[model samples]
Target: MAIEGPFWRAIAVFRVASLVYATVLMAQYRGYEQPMLGWLVIGVMALWTAGATFAYSVRALRRWPLPAIDLLTALACLLASPYVQGAGQGAAGTLPVPATWVAAPVLAWAVYGGRRAGTAAGIVVAAGDLWLRIREPDVPIMINGAVLLVMAGVVVGHVARLAKQAEARMQRAFEMEAAQRERERLARDIHDGVLQVLALVQRRGRRLGGEAAELGRLAGEQEAALRELVSGTAPQPEGATDLRTLLTRHGSPDVTISTPATPLVLPTETARSLAAAVGAALDNVRAHCGPGARAWVLAESGDGTVTVSVRDDGPGIPDGRLEEAAGDGRMGVARSIRGRVAELGGEVSIVSVHGQGTEIEITLPA
Candidate 1:
């Protein structure tokens, strides 16, 4: 159901309850200028209350014009209070004929247009009440009552807005879950059919000799790329995860992590990809550097960009070694690290020399 349904129903109940309260008050304060006319006005309030309840229950009727008419009707009822209760009685602090019933339209405006609209509606009704004070020299304005009316508008409107935002987030989460399920189904289909065929071709071609070995190499590369595609690493439209958390997991006696006091939040996909790139760099460290080698990861964020640096105190890359590795189809640096960063609109810089340590700096748009 729509979030506004309960609010409208609550307003309906308030109107009915307030109507009953006003009727009992009218019976106690019976000295009106025209008692018969006052009862006729009460009848009108009953009809209008029923009509408004029906109107507000329909989503199509809860627009600006309906609320505007509702507010105007409320003011009319408030203005008629002096005639119905006698101006002298009102001056003695007698409650208006509609009593708390006047607040119903303020709530309607709140549910329709949010805090500002509700406040405006409250002001209009308060003005009508204040007009009575001006017309009768002895009539005292209830400042607290006016303030309460305005406060009700502001508070209810704020609550309504929050409800809408929560509903939208819930809807998006459901959509993302459905999309994830569909992706998993498609991945299963492809893995069973096309992926298996590619793997078979890669195996058989490599066994067939010179030209076939080259074909097998190409097939193996395609299979790897396709597998990555089916890995369910799509970017999400909502939520953020801290990059510091992902990096901290790599910390140990040999690996050190330095991060800001505050969180280094990024889109979930961006953070994961960057963390994976750092993982790839660490993998290279474990393969080339000895098991006892040490590494440090530093994460920093500022000025619309986030940078993560992975440094290792180990024998560094030799000149032209990365290029040779790429030529030999060993793409640890060329594909895993660089490809991931590039996809996130980021840049990767590697500084390394034969005997010195190596540092990989990745900078991404925040």
Candidate 2:
């Protein structure tokens, strides 16, 4: 069975205990004759006692705010029961009725609201009853009930504070687990799908004739864009891949791009991807063309198409070698750049002589 919280459990204990206390006090006094008004009052008090307990039973199943309601009910019962005892009329034999239990409301409020408010609640309740002077004119009521109520309030308030802290920690742990799952999902998508396709295009585009060239170009562009996105530094969309802009960033300080005076507006996704592809090729130049190799970026815009060429003063690739490498499933040229261009309905071609140097001439339908 699910456990009831201290608040509701405490209320149940109080209800049964208070009911016993009230019944005992009533049984001890018999001299007061039953008056019609006294019976009516007793009936009402009985209703409150039973009603408060019923409320406690439901609280374990739902948050019923039982404390606030129970406090009012208990007060009403105490108020009605004292009149039924007929002690306010100064009945001497009945040991004088004292409605001091009215202050029990402070205990109810404290456990519900917590320690920070419990002290103030106890003060207000004690003061309210003192202000009213709940004793019959000549009677001295027991102070023990008030002291017990105050203690209950303090203990329950402290317990509630600890419960609230435990709930907060549990919520934070669930959130951390959810966040880690999302990160794993992102890493998997990048590794298996996007990166693999780009690698294939970049390698194949290097050697194969015709559309194989185009496939290689598209792959290269996607790989660059993906890398940037993963790093949280994807390029801002201005237009399609700006070959000149990308080349300038990766190109040597001496390397320059020749372009139209008006900047072309390319699709930003296309532009960044393409630029990244060219940048990858430039990286190749720097790595393979020797430290002394110089490079340039050239671009042209027309007919909804764009072309970017990265040329280097470096030793050129041998003709049969690139195809041989692809046959073995090596992906450097096939997937790195050409695949992306092919996806974009364009082609990539590389021209080179073993001694004359190399040029990566890539054309994409704008």
Candidate 3:
């Protein structure tokens, strides 16, 4: 059964109201006794009972448990009330001991919630009645009440633990929702602000002359990096891609970025991811093989797939070395290239021979 917090709140309210009723009855009965003394003691007990009720109402606001106060109040009544009983049972009738009425709310606070709160209150009640134990050594009534109160406290403590666990779970749920929204927002900004600027620069580069054309070329590389990020195709950024453009400018002054001679259609998303992957692969050629490293960019389309290969005449990756490089957080080859390719239902295989060179193969479903 789903236990709504309001249900516990209603139970707390009822327990308090019952205590208030018991208080009023005790006060009315004591009005016929030594008016002043009787009224004063009743008022003190009533105040304590009211205090316990107020604690439950705002218990959640407190960082620590507060229902302990209710238990303390009960113990006070058990001890004090017995002492205030009839001084002479000879000619006069027995004076009423209103301890149980005070004890009732304390018990409820302990039991309703769980054992800890209940046991604490029960100890006070039992200890408070210790005077009776001294007077009648044969009767162990005080110890009996104490044992019962302890049992109640144990139950209340367990219940409070459950309530606290529920509160923690509720707080964590709110935090996760807030975090997910933040990730979505960051993705949008990279697409609109960074990616858009890079795209503009790439478009203007082909027409510009001299250094202006070089500036546009750098922008084109950034566009590819941003494109991968916006799509979440690559978890890592292609940082060394800037070097790829420097190599291209030096190696071939009239760099012709050729598209297929025949019209080949690809998913807009697939093309964007492929561009980012190719951009990272080119970066590896420049950084490791050096700017003088001769490289070829080839794209072939057929069989509902497209493959882009970057082959470089630089020292190739050692056998089983690509995994070691990726493990170090240099995700240029892993996150930026393989990650993007994998997202597009693609395959990547790197063939490198010592002293020969390296060839990176990437094939993606169109």
Candidate 4:
């Protein structure tokens, strides 16, 4: 059951207990301006107690009208106490006819509308109790009941508000757990079924040489895309993008991407700039080598820095090739990859050894 169930039940129990206490007090003290009229008021209190308990127990009935009526009822009973016990009785330290029974509405308001509502209800009842002092002449004012009423309203209301917040947090936690479980189950199913078929097609296409090989390559790309989708990378918040999500999009049969298992959250513009730089490197591999040449993209984040490395299995760039290209106005390497990284307060390092392929590593402050 929800946390609120126990609160309502407790309120119901308190109402019943307070009602019994009031009945005993009224019976014990027979002195009154009108004894029969006082019992009539007690009868009204009994009926209202039963009605309030019923109303509060129903979820739909715990609204403005009910709580409003509840406070008004309690105030009526409290004010009636003066007439029932006579003005001098309360001034002489005798308990009111309703006694502590009037605090029920305060607790109800606290539970219904939190601390402020509870406190307001307490003040209303306390004011009515204090007003009784006006009826008594030349007697020391008793404010203990008023003080206790206000305190109960404030404390109980605060507790009820905290309980509501705790309940909300618990609900969100349960929803996230259930979603994770479902995602894991789906990932397992895809790994066992579709992933195996895609892997087989990729292997067979690689063994065969022509159009079938191309078809197999496409299948491999689809397989890679599927793997990333089920990798349990949740969507990032607005204005923020996970670098892995953008980097993984570049994954293919010929191109592989490796990123941290956890999210690499960055500003949307930063992640996009990084991913675009990586894409340029891959474009270089396809332009320099054949389409069949493979590449790997590695993304790492640590020590307040983010690094991405794009390495391609292609004939390495000849010595001074980038400088030569920049001199010739062929700025693919200088402009596309290097310039983008440099603008973002980062440095790019290109390593190429004749037969060992080329690697471009970009590092940025996180």
What's the TM-score of each model vs. the native? 0.63, 0.43, 0.44, 0.68
Q: Write the per-residue lDDT of candidate 2 for residues 129-236, one digit (tens) a residue.
A: 433345555655545545665666687678766777777766666765665565567767777877787777777774683677546655665665565444432233
The TM-score ranking, best first, is: 4, 1, 3, 2
Where is model 3 more than 4 Å wrong at Cα? 1-15, 18-39, 51-71, 86-124, 129-135, 140-148, 181-193, 196-366
Q: Which of candidates 1 and 4 reaches a greater TM-score?
A: 4
Q: Which scores higher on TM-score, 1 or 2?
A: 1
Number of the top candidate by lDDT? 4
Looking at model 1, residue 167 earns an lDDT score of: 92
Q: In model 4, which residue pairs have backbone atoms overlapping below 3 Å?
A: none
TM-score of 3: 0.44
User: What's each prediction's clash count?
Assistant: 0, 48, 13, 0
lDDT by residue (146-223, candidate 4, tens digit) is 899889989999998899999888887787788878878889988999989999998899889587887787788788
TM-score of 2: 0.43
What C-alpha lDDT, on a 0 to 100 scale, does residue 240 get in candidate 3?
Answer: 21
lDDT-better candidate, 1 vs 2: 1
Clash pairs (backbone) in predicted model 1:
none
Candidate with top TM-score is 4
Residue-level lDDT for 198 in candidate 2: 76
Residues 112-183 of candidate 3 have per-residue lDDT tens digits of: 555655565666666655555566444433355556656655665577667666877776667656655665
- Estimate every model's Cα lDDT from 0 to 1: 0.84, 0.61, 0.58, 0.85
